[model samples]
Target: MEALTLTTPALLFSAVSLILLAYTNRFLGYASLVRQLYEKLKANPDQVLLDQIMNLRKRLYLIKNMQLLGVASLMFCVLSMFLIYIEVFLPAAYAFGLGLLLLIISLLLSGWEIKISVRALDLHLNDMEHFSEDNS
Candidate 1:
């Protein structure tokens, strides 16, 4: 097998950084939505609003996990590079492989969270359609 170079894991740094940024953006968006929902709940409590809050709670957990895994992946990549610098190729390769595995899990979590978000939006659209039918 070919030896793993420092550059091998170094390439993952940029990709992981971008994924972390995207996760942060999603977190901020959820924070804003939660604040809005909190106020709405205080003004007038309703089942639909409560359901949305529950859904947001689940998505927030998913985003948090994704951010954590992405950071671990980034950390491992750095660790692997340092190992490679010290001429420890075997251990470095193992660390790099772990980093890649973590990144894959993070991406999978992100995709799952997105699917939940879309389903939430679909519920709202269905409500709107029902309202339109009632009006007609």
Candidate 2:
């Protein structure tokens, strides 16, 4: 394998930064949805709203984990760069590899969250379809 260089870890900086920004946006959107749901539930408690809230809760948990892993991956990349700067090639390589692994896991969790999100949207669509059918 080629020697670990500072540039190797530095390459992840932009990708990770973009990913973190996306994750933060997702988190903020969920926060807003939760607040809206809370008010709706208070006004008229329904099973469907309860289920949607539960789904959001799960998605929020996954997002939290995703953000945590992404941040950790970025931290590892920085650490790898620092290690390489100090002439610790072996540890630097390990750190870089771990950072990559964390990033991969974070992305996988993101995919799972997206799937859940789609399912939630599907539920809403189904409800609309049923309502239309009944009206028709």
The estimated TM-scores of all candidates read 0.97, 0.98
**Which pairs clash in model 2?**
none
After superposition on all C-alphas, the RMSD of every candidate to the true structure, in Å, is 0.8, 0.6
Task: Estimate the lDDT of model 1.
Answer: 0.97
Model 2 sits at a Cα RMSD from the real structure of 0.6
For model 1, residues 25-134, the per-residue Cα lDDT tens digits are 99999999999999999999999999999999999999999999999999999999999999998899999999999999999999999999999999999999999999
Q: Write the per-residue lDDT of candidate 2 for residues 1-136, one digit (tens) a residue.
A: 6788788899997799999999999999999999999999999999999999999999999999999999999999999999999999899899999999999999999999999999999999999999999999
Candidate 1's TM-score reads 0.97
lDDT of each: 0.97, 0.96
Candidate 2 clashes: the total is 0
